[model samples]
Target: MTKQELKEYYWIRRNITKSEQRLIELETAATKITAQLKNKHDAIMGQGNTSDKVGNTVADMELVRDEMTEQIKRSYAVLAKLEKAIEELPAREGYLIRSRYIELLSWEQIAVDMNYSWKQIHRIHAEALHQLQ
Candidate 1:
């Protein structure tokens, strides 16, 4: 692969990974909020409920919600960076990298489609990183 291809591949991989991780983090936060909500419901049903407990749960859920919103914003930022990086990549490399990384294709599939050896694809990806720097 060419240096341009390598750079495109690296940037695409980075963005995809970042976006995916952010999504996971967002999900985790949502899960925590759900758990807190359930706890709050239980607390309400139970005797000896206090305003302090309810207020604390609401606050925690709000904090988690806010954090999830932030994570979503981060995901959008990653996507934007990915878009800019794609635009900067050489045409051929951009197509291949986007197809393989963003679309999440396996190396064998990308190789077969591109008529490139696996080693060649790896080299292209590596060189792309070097060229990027």
Candidate 2:
């Protein structure tokens, strides 16, 4: 792969991590909303006007949850493709790609982990991209 292609892959991988985080946040929100709706459903008696408002709120939250679920599915699919592409690379290069992108590690952190200078890691990354093509 060209350097630019490899850079694109790296960005896509990074996006997967970000999307995964967003998925978690969305799911959490959905769960909270579900709980609130459940509580409101159970208390169906005194608060008549409040119940109508809660009904509308629950419907809106359900729509948001459905949208988030679809987004999470798409993110997973993209991440899978990027992962499969990196799987063909040599061990060191693949590790570097995963660390920097999928794992979302900083260059300094990756260098520390691999016991190499950050500059050397970048050099290796550039070389690795050639093999990817």
Candidate 3:
């Protein structure tokens, strides 16, 4: 993989996390909307039509939910591919890549965890990227 492709692992992971969070938020909103709609229906039962508003809201939410779900699926596919590639590397290389991208660890933290000097960690990271290619 090129550097850009390798770098995308971090983005894909981030997107997955954000998408999942958004899904939770959407679910909460949907529940609240449902409750509100029920109350509105009871209040305005024969006075006016609520179907249009309810239909529009439900359609919009479903569109957003479907889009987010697809994004999450695609992100997971990329993440799985990246993870498999990382797993194929040597132990140290795999660790470096996983730590930096998947675990979102800082270089210093990775160096400390790996018991290597900062400069040495960079060197290892370079080698890991090369192996990834």
RMSD of each predicted structure: 6.7, 4.8, 2.4
User: Which model scores highest in lDDT?
Assistant: 3
Query: What is candidate 3's lDDT per residue for 1-133, written digit by digit as tens?
Result: 6667777888777788888999999878888887777777866566566756775787799899999999899888877888789989999989998898778899999999999999999999999988887
Model 2 misplaced stretches (Cα beyond 4 Å): 1-50, 103-120
Q: What tens-digit string does per-residue lDDT give for candidate 1 at 1-133?
A: 3334433545555665675676567567657766765677766566465645655665775676567567656656656766677667776666667666667688788788888999888777665545445
Where's the lowest-lDDT run of ten residues in candidate 3? Answer: 42-51
Q: Is candidate 1 or candidate 2 better by lDDT?
A: 2
What ranges in model 1 sit over 4 Å off? 1-49, 117-127
Every candidate's lDDT: 0.64, 0.74, 0.84
RMSD of 1: 6.7
Model 3 segments beyond 4 Å from truth? 39-45
* C-alpha lDDT (0 to 100) for residue 123 of candidate 1: 76
Candidate 2 lDDT, tens digit per residue, 1-133? Answer: 4545444655665676776677677667767867777777757647677777766776776677677677767766765766787898888889998787657689999999988998999988887777767
Clashing residue pairs, candidate 3? 1-133
By TM-score, how accurate is candidate 3?
0.79
Best by TM-score: 3
- Give the Å shift of residue 126 in candidate 2: 1.9
